[model samples]
Target chain A: MLGDIKTVAQGTFDRYFKMKELYVILILCILNIAALSRYDVLTLNMGKEFMIDGALAILTVVALITSMAVIFEKSRELREKTAHFIITKPYGRSSYIWGKFIGISFLAIFNMAILTAGALIVFKLTSYENVMANNLATEFIYAALLITAEAIVLTALGLFFSMFLSDTITALMVLVFFILGHSFYILEKMSSESSKIFGWVSDILPNLHNLDLKSAITDNITITQDVLGYGLLYAVLYAVAFVAASSMIFSRKDIS
Target chain B: MYAIETHNLYKTFGWFLSKRKVHALNNLELKVPENVIYGFLGPNGAGKTTTIKILLGLVIPSKGHSKIFGIDTHDPDTRNHVGFLPENPKFYPYLTASDFLDFCGKIIHMDAMERSKRKDELLEKVGLTHAANQKMEGFSRGMLQRMGIAQALISDPDLIILDEPITGLDPMGRADIKRILLELREEGKTIFFSSHILSDVERMCDMVGIINHGQLIEHGSLDELRSDIGVNIHTTGVASNALMEGEKLCDYITLKNGEAIFTLTNKSDKDTVMKFISDNGGSVIRSVKLQEELEAFFLRRIQNDEKAREEEVN
Candidate 1:
């Protein structure tokens, strides 16, 4: 397991290094988000302006991009026929599924990490009294935890779609899932306001809105322990189901 | 005992609407004796690849069974002992030949020393030592194929399955692969491969199976195939009326004017017939057995079937 993890980590880091487009967009957004602090409009209440509004947008975009990373990976692997090399060994199916998930998941985290780091650097540079005085440690940890859950669910969803779909369909469907996955909160809200059928639909829908905890980080709002625990549990359960499902589907697949 | 066996193997693809179920292997039966270079011959859509795929466990047999080394193919152990190379071999383009082999070694879970020793040995055998470190992305078709062979042989498997191993090779490349296959055979490995090059099969194979239209029309040793070319002889310098209408020679020999032609189906019977003709009052003329080229023999069989279908329709 350690060897597998190491191999996956190396492969992921190597891939992240090469995916210039990803790094470029992510860095640009981090800088863009940091620069938004220049506007007093966003600084009125750090909670409402920076964390709630600004961080919500970042989490949504990151979730969407990370989900699509599944397609990026599947296209490269399927098109190049790398599966033949990977599929013929011990733990081949699981290694391929999880290795890819972690690879892209780590990349997604790195993107978010850069933003958080950038936010800290801006605080250091600007030395805003509240930004400097307020302890970012707790809120940063909360933000990290929320992003991790979001990354897990998105990665699972991505892997599920990638397992059976061809390169093109995998990419397209992941895009669809990303858009739909991130908007699950709205879907659920809309469904609840509609009919009983909608209620049932919302019940099945994963509440991604719960994953958005940027307000707590930016505005220094305290996150309830139960709420955090529920979101964590939901992400874990969803990830486990999807990964298990992908394993079953891929196990029977003919690599030739 | 045979190293590989298949009974009534049938596979169909596609379903419903466009339902173009290619009965890729229609009740195809095969038995490959252990420790021989078994050349599987076929044209396009002849189900050669399909049979190989089924044997390699890359496919599900719709209604039949196959075994390798006396073990059922669906058994995981069977795959562990068998090595395969698909037609149009595809590998990770980013990986060099050595890295690819290393990856494959890791996949099959070979111990470090064993994988390295085997990798070096296979690279040398395939003559890819100079290019081992070069990325496969720019390798020629023949190079890719050679690396593919090397990859398959990494585990030093009991049975090696190659689909069209030498199809798109220059003379030298073909010779190299044939040499390697021969060497592997010398090492007591069972090599089963398909090829359109009938001559290659004729030269390399101890046993050959020809599949066409999802059916195994013929299979046996090359000598058996040559014999099955079936008794056609044309000759000149024969005395007139050498063949009597009701004679055993009549059944075996065809007379063309003054010339007596007899295909030697059985060598011993050829002498007996000649003696009978001489004793029966007709002079024996020149007689020789003819050998049909494998290609000609294949074309004739396929053509005859077409003719039979046409006549049936009429």
Candidate 2:
């Protein structure tokens, strides 16, 4: 089963890497981050805050794009029946779901790393003294890690929804989930004032806010070890739950 | 034990909005023995592909069960000894032919050494060696079909199931697939395939099953399914008067250049026809039993099944 998962993961990663459109999007994203980091309007005094904000925002977009790429590819696999080649092999359906999730998550991480690296380079190249005095490198790394957690959750969510829904519907659901995940506090607030259903929804929705450390970076507030550890734990739990649900749904699915 | 077996397998697809159900398979009982080429024959939407999918555990049956090599198909290990090629197979277009096979090998858990060896052997066998490194996106339909076959054999499975394996192939490609299937059978592999090419099935299958309306209309050896319809007797030197007597014994007779041809719908009439021709001083030339072709037999069975269903409905 491990071998099957590895094969599918490697295959999925290779397939996504070979898509010229994906590369084009990635390149555009890197350039966008580069330009945003070196924007002249943000003076050197505010350079760290501005660069980190823009980079994290761009990273979110990259994560969303990577998630959508996964959804679209899985959708095409089912629509074109290419998945038959893999699903009919001597491997469990759970392995397929895990493989896809892992593969696309790796791509998401790669994209995030490249964008983060590009943003950091531009920040250092444009504002050398600011970097030395403030020591924003660690903060940027923390911000990237938080975004990576968010990307992992989104990728798993995308894979889960794509298993049972059409491409358009899956994308819409993932997008809605991402929005709701980040605004879970709104749902929590609504629950206190309005209805218990909102409370239930908030509980079920992943609290992506926990993983949002951009403010921490921009404000130069040190993110405690406890907070970072909890955030990572939350992301892992949410991602695992989504993947487990996906596996259960996919195991009984008719690949016809 | 049968290489493939299904007991009262039933499946139905339901439209969620309309609440209308399409019965794809109804009490489908099939038994395919090991080490033989079994041809599954059916018209479009006759449940051939559905049955194959069920056997591969790609689709779940609404009722009943199927087993491969005596193990339930729902078990993933059941596929350890089986390889399948779907109809109009689609692959990861970005992958080269060689890479695609290697991926397939890994799915079946073949180690790197075994995968490498099998990859080369299958590519050469399928005549795709030249395009080993070329992306499958650039392949023609025939090349893709060959690639499909190669992947199906990458595991060196005990049972190989293919749906419409020869649909997009030229005559030579078809012949090559036929040779491969035959060779696999010789090596103790059971092959179950469905194809619209009845002539190819007729040439390769040791046993066949014809299905329609989600039911098995015919299942048996080719010879058993294609019973001798009648016999034709050719004779020479039969006097015109004797020819008339021979015609009375036979279903019909034709004469040309002092030669007589007798066609009998009944096999028993052949001996009588021959004896009468001998008594009439006519020399027998040859006698040939006329048997139905698989295509004709398949059509006749399906038509009869449809007629029966109509009568039942009426």
Candidate 3:
């Protein structure tokens, strides 16, 4: 089973790589690197706040693009029935769910890692004296990690909807899930104004606001290890639950 | 052990509330022995694809069960010894032939060295060695079909199931596939395939099953099915009057150029017809006994089923 997952992961990665989507993401990374490095060179005295925001924007765009690419490829596979060649092999549906989730997650992490490293290099080379004074180094890394976790959860949701839904519906559904997950706190507040029971119901939706750490980093709020660990745990739980549901639905779906 | 065994298998599609139920397979009891090419004969909408899908674990059967090499079809491990080519399968267009086969080999847990070796060998066998590096998006229909075969054989599986493998190929393409299938059979692989071309099945199938309207109407060796239709006698150099009338035991008789051609429901009619020819001042230059062809047998069975259904409705 492990071998099957690895095979599917590699296959998915290669397919995406061939589609030139990865190249686009790479180009985006390069642009971010050049822009950040130029900013650092022009204003050596500029504070670390600008650097942290640059890292956040680059990673967030990378995450969104990776999710969209993964979802689009999966939809095409279903539409063309190309997935039959893979699913009918000597592997169960769980392998597919894990493989796709991990495959897309790996792409997301790899992209974020490259851009984050580039951002760090620019910061260290230009703003070495201010890096630790403003805590920009650690905060930049934390922001990248946070976005990667969010991307993992989003990848799982995209795969879940792609299993049985059409391309348009799957895209629309995933987009809605992402928007609601991030802004669920607003619903919670509105519900609390009406009744306590309603507020609890609203909380049933995954509160992705917890995963957003950009504000926390930019505001220089102290993000302890416990806070990061809790955020990671929440993302992992949601990803696991979504992937499990995808496997169950995909296993029973009629490929015809 | 049988290569494939399905006992009282059944499948139905659609829901129950204002639902349209399609009985894809109805009590289909099939047993195909090892190391033989079995032709699954049927027309469109005859449940041929459904049965293959059920056995491949693509669609769950509504009733009963099926097994491959004594292992249940529902189990993923059962596919370890099996290879399948879905009807007109569409592969990942982004993958080249080499990459596609490599992916298939990896899914089967083949070692890297062995996977590379088999990939080269299968691409050559399918006449796609030159196109191994070309992506499938530029492939023609025939090329895709050949690649499908190559992928199915990547694992060198024991049991191979193909649906309509040679439907729309040109003569040369059809012949190439036929040759490949024959070679596979020679290597002692069990092949179960469905085809609209009766001649191909008649030439290659060791055993056959005729299905219609979700039911297995006939199943046995070609000879066994042929024997049920008795014998056909074609005679020449005989007077047409000999087949004209009186004690004519032939069911269907056609005469041309003073020769007689007809079918004998029983062997006893052969001697009687010859004697009549001799008494009519004629002679039998040639007499051959031939059995009914697969096409005829298939049509007869399907027609009977349709007639029965009509009778019940009326």
Best by TM-score: 2
Off by over 4 Å in 1: A1-31, A34-63, A88-95, A106-119, A126-129, A132-141, A163-166, A186-203, A215-220, A224-226, A254-256, B16-18, B227-290, B305-314
The model with the greatest lDDT is 2
lDDT of 2 by residue, A185-226 (tens): 677678765468876677578778888888877788877768
lDDT of 1 by residue, A106-150 (tens): 776776677667655655565354554545544654666677678
Q: Tens digit of lDDT per residue, candidate 1, span B1-314?
A: 67899998998875535556667888898999889999988778888877886786656788889999888877756777777777776776677889878867766667789878889999999999999899998999889988988988888898898888898899888988899899999999999999889887778989888888788887888677764433544455445555544245534666577656665554435566556555555554544545677777677777776687689999
Clashing pairs in 1: A47-A219, A89-B107
Question: Model 3's DockQ?
Answer: 0.56
Candidate 2 chain B minimal-lDDT segment of 10 residues: B266-275
TM-scores across all candidates? 0.77, 0.89, 0.82
Better of 1 and 2 by DockQ: 2
lDDT-better candidate, 1 vs 3:
3
Looking at model 1 chain A, report the run of 10 residues with the lowest lDDT sum: A47-56
Stretches of candidate 2 off by over 4 Å are A37-39, A42-48, A131-133, A187-203, B15-18, B232-286
Among residues 3 or more apart in sequence or in different chains, the pairs in candidate 3 whose N, CA or C atoms overlap within 3 Å are none
DockQ for each numbered candidate: 0.24, 0.71, 0.56
Per-residue C-alpha lDDT of model 3 across residues A69-143, encoded as one tens digit per residue: 677876666556566677787665678768877888888888778778877776666644565566667866777
Return the lDDT, model 1, position A108: 69
For candidate 2, the clash count comes to: 0
- DockQ rank, highest first? 2, 3, 1
